[model samples]
Target chain A: MGTFLIVDDDESLHKVLVRVLKLEGHKVVGSVYNGSEAVEFIRNSKTKPDIILMDHRMPVMDGTTATREILALDSTQRILFISADETAESEALKAGAVGFLLKPIRSADLFRAVKSCLGEK
Target chain B: MDPMQIAWHLMEGTNDIITSINKDGTFSYVNRALMEKLHYSESEIDTLSIGTIFFPGEQKKIKAIVTKDTHEIISDVQTIMVTKEGEMLHVEGAFSPFFEGGKKVSTIALFRDISKQKKMEEDLERERNQTEFLIDIMTHDLANIHQEIISMLDFLILNEDLPNETVGIIKEGISEIERATRLISSVRKISIVSKALPDLQCMDISLALLRGAIQARLAFPEKTLKLVTDVEHGEYFVVADEYLVDIFYSLLHNSLKHSKKKDVTI
Candidate 1:
């Protein structure tokens, strides 16, 4: 089981992703609204999550810039971008995101991506 | 008949308006069609000019075209003109520089009234914008709502230790949510067809069928479905997108809905 930090503007999604991750035997370490909070969460936390579920569109900061910032702080940080916008897939990947999942993501697909990010078979 | 006379007769007989304006925007010549459409008589022609004929809002634009320096034809210049009654008339026409003794002196303009076409085009654009706006709400906002419901259902299915029948019912509810999501996706695809092409990739047809079967079974939990196919997963591939799964799901859902037998094999 892996640990995850959920970052998304949608509160409904945060609840769902956290519950789904917990149901699948993974720990949701933290949840934040935007990318800037996510950066702050990672910077202050003593124990970082194994994977970060990043969202693209947000009010204060976007996922791409946040991904770049967090990865700059720690290159080993794993980020999996989850967004409703399909166009953000390439941008997320280019910004040091390990994976990109479009929104309305099935729990199965989300698990697969998380497992892949964790380097699990 | 002389060709010049025939040409003049043709210009006079056509429904298209023809008028020549001097450098100072004064009417040099006005065809019968122009005079009749603009409600100007030969006696009143001296009082009319480019400024008097063009719609008030369109005067500067029309004047620029009429007084342009180009000898080349300015084609399909769409603008509004005002009739004697002050009614706006949509027109699209061409302007040609009229030269005398190798010096440009006036502009000869020919116009066809397109008020009906313009109204129809504007109505269509308004309707299209409204449709796209609704589709945006459905795809983004409504889609999130659907996702929330699906997630709730999924959570119940995994966490709740309910009876087998209750779990089946919950699964059916999730399937209904998926169906609604598919409808929203279909509307999104239709709206974006003119904007961008579909993203097609090499998809495993068998996998799509399997996924469809699983989701379809969720919709009919009371029924025992046995999908018997010779095709193996990853063996058969087709150029398709995620819509392929939607198609398969729709077909299987219809088949299951119409079937009378509780236990069906396909």
Candidate 2:
């Protein structure tokens, strides 16, 4: 199990995802509303999350911009983008996200992605 | 004044560019409309040949029109005419051979500007293409997302130890999203049919319906749904595509899934 952070605009998504990951025995580090908030959380928080589930297309800032800023703050922080828009795939990768996953993901797949970030086989 | 002089004044008053070109392809007479359109004085036009009046690359089409021998006037021939500043002017007109004293002397042609009309047509085409593209993306991508949402909700319901009330809410959410997905797919199918009308072909629709029935039965092995059709077996031809089968399958599926009866004829 790994520590994970959730950054998405939809509060309902955050609730369901947090509950699902928690049920799988992963630590729920924090939740941020958008890219800018995620960057702020990463900067201020002393204990950084092992992985970040970043969502593309948010109000304050988007996942790509936040990922770039967060990576600058901490180069090794693992960030995986979860987006419904496939058009933003290239931008997500360019911003240094480890992977891109489309939304409505199963809990098992989400757990698997978290494990992968933790370097599990 | 002679009868021909009065006729010339009447020709000059019309909006269209009227010109009479000699058999040698030189301008015999260019009306006031023609001179105004190209910003050319009568003396300037007198010095220019018919070939010089039209830009190159239009020569072949112009030649075909000028050389054709027919008693009837040929209408709707599009040609490019050049302005004084060398700008292309789009025009459509009729070419009629003029005769003098029982001998063919020149070809009389009338040109009307169609540039604005063409531009409007092009804009409408672009708008239509854009709308189709957007509908396609919404149907394909949005439906996929909706499917994913339902899948997640189903898994959560199955695996989680949630309260009965919470599970009820989740199930309700799932049904609503499914309905939304079906509506989107229906709209997308409509757009697809409109955009792909040319792909329609004549085929035996009976075979397609039978296949749809078999697929529907396989999809719902537990449900007793009968596919009822009055189509004969010889050859029921239909100008359609694979989507026709999908339409039948969806109808059968929806009928069976919604009806309260254990055995429903669809």
Candidate 3:
């Protein structure tokens, strides 16, 4: 399992995700609230997560902007958008996202999509 | 400058074939643009009729517009014509009647080479013909690969005699894969229907949404439905076409498939 950095606005998701991800033998390196925080974290941090789950909606910055900023910092960054919004597909794809897990993503899919992005599958 | 001098300069400078033909369709005047593109010298092309460029039997269309009464400008349209090297070139432009004394004595035609657009269209048509091959890969070939993972999961769960908890998780994973495959099949059907480009019809969209929820229930037996409309339920007429139900099915399925919550409110 790969190390994941989750960027979602919903605080409730952080606990549930950690519980589900830890059970799958994956590690959650960090969790951020908005796109700006994610960008800041990625840029300033020493150890980077293997895959990032970017949320489509947020308070300060959206996932697409965060994805763009992170990629600009490091082109090899692997980021995904797990969104419930149907209209997010085109925007997510346009932002150079590697994969998208439509919400409410099951435990198995979250694992699979992460592994796929990590080049494990 | 004199009128003839200005006319000559305009004809020679533009990036189009400008030629005036006689009433009998024999070329009377040829511009530099025409000579350059058709690879014909001025004197040689003046002897050639406009009919020389027309594709075989298609010359009759030009010839039929013989009299002043029948003369009209043929506007931007695409047609095939033989170039100087006998290569078929797609030309897109117009042809207009030239009058000497308020009576049409000849015609002047302007055309630009459009072989690039024609080539692109031909390539697209070729790819479009391979739709069945694409569908085959999406459905049949892809399913084979998916089945391999499933069979491996099955072997591990059954033959190896794993712990009950581990086996249950494996089964859950397999079910997820199965769900994904079913989604792919549904996507394929919808993709094919959408590509066919059905005509749009006005219908009660609220009714369609209600019917679509019913369809989703039928399609996925395990999934429960609780469709709530933001608007009051009534005859909500909308400009939509076929597969209105499929649209709702896709939207409704996404929420159901991934939601950890028992009761969804979308």
Candidate 4:
């Protein structure tokens, strides 16, 4: 079982992702509401998660900025960008995200993304 | 040099009523124009105080100008003054300090009736305020109904698991409502924003464009689509609102739905 952090502004989408990931037997470290909180949590954590599922658009700070800051803190952080907006995929890739998942994300697609980021088949 | 000669010259030459008051407020000089306008003789004018000719509220402002130690000028002050017949007239005036050598002597005020202009300005201001109030009520209050309808449709799309036919009907209904709402909202927003437009914040434009393309793909899953992104390595920021990105997403969704080709590029 791998630990993962889910960050998104939408509460409903966050809850859905948490439920689905939990059902997949992954240990959910935490779920946060915005990119800034995700950065703060990652910076202050004693142990980093195996993977991070990040949303692109949020208030205060966005996923791209959070990704850059988090990677600055720990270069080995594995990030997967998940958003409803598809245009963020390449930018997320440039920001060092291993995978990109669009909104209304299927369970299979999400599982595959998380697995891909974890370097498992 | 003579008081009567000075008074006669003033009355014959100008329409203005020339008057002088002593330090005790008794009238010292009154022109023929003054007597004709007020129907008061020179003797009657001398017996009356300067304060007696002022309207109740005008006394305060007049007193302030009169009692100042140094030379002072009051310009275009609008206030009411009373005639000898006790009729109130709205007037605008300039009050200047009169000086003898280095000492303050008296205050001389020249005034004109401005009741017509004052009434016109008040009417114009009232109309302007009423128009603004009506517009605010329509946009802020009535526009919320459209927003609520959009929110409800979003909820339905996210939560409801209906048959394909029912989903199609609901989606069509949502599209029609959105179209009508956009038209009304745009008109209202244009009027409101024209009055006061907010500053835009810098945003990542490429990210928004990419998100718009992805949302289009999701909206039409049956269509084979290719979203070609050409975002540079460095930061690509532009000034815009995030809500506009969602509008672009909606436009792309419409394009994808209507496209006849097997492969559509965004």
Q: Which candidate comes out best when scored by DockQ?
A: 1
By lDDT, who's the top model here? 1
For model 1, what is the alpha-carbon lDDT of residue A49?
92
TM-score quality measure for candidate 2: 0.52
| Models sorted by TM-score, best on top | 1, 3, 2, 4
Candidate 4 lDDT by residue in tens digits, B112-200: 66657877888987886687667644543333344345444444555556667776765666555545544544555455555566557
- For candidate 1, write residues B88-195 as lDDT tens digits: 889999999988788889998999999999999999989989988787655667656776777777777775568888897887787777667666766777677766
**Candidate 3 Cα outliers beyond 4 Å, as residue runs:** A1-121, B66-68, B101-103, B136-182, B185-196, B215-224, B229-234, B263-266
TM-score of each: 0.66, 0.52, 0.53, 0.41
Report lDDT (Cα) of residue B236, candidate 4: 89
Model 2 has a DockQ score of 0.09
Best by TM-score: 1
Report residue B3 deviation for candidate 1 (angstroms). 7.5
Better of 2 and 3 by lDDT: 2
lDDT against the true structure, each candidate: 0.84, 0.78, 0.73, 0.69
Off by over 4 Å in 4: A1-121, B1-50, B82-88, B151-266
Give the per-residue Cα lDDT of candidate 2 at B119. 81
Query: In candidate 1 chain B, what residue range of length 10 has the lowest lDDT sum?
Result: B136-145
| RMSD, every candidate, angstroms | 5.7, 9.8, 18.6, 13.5
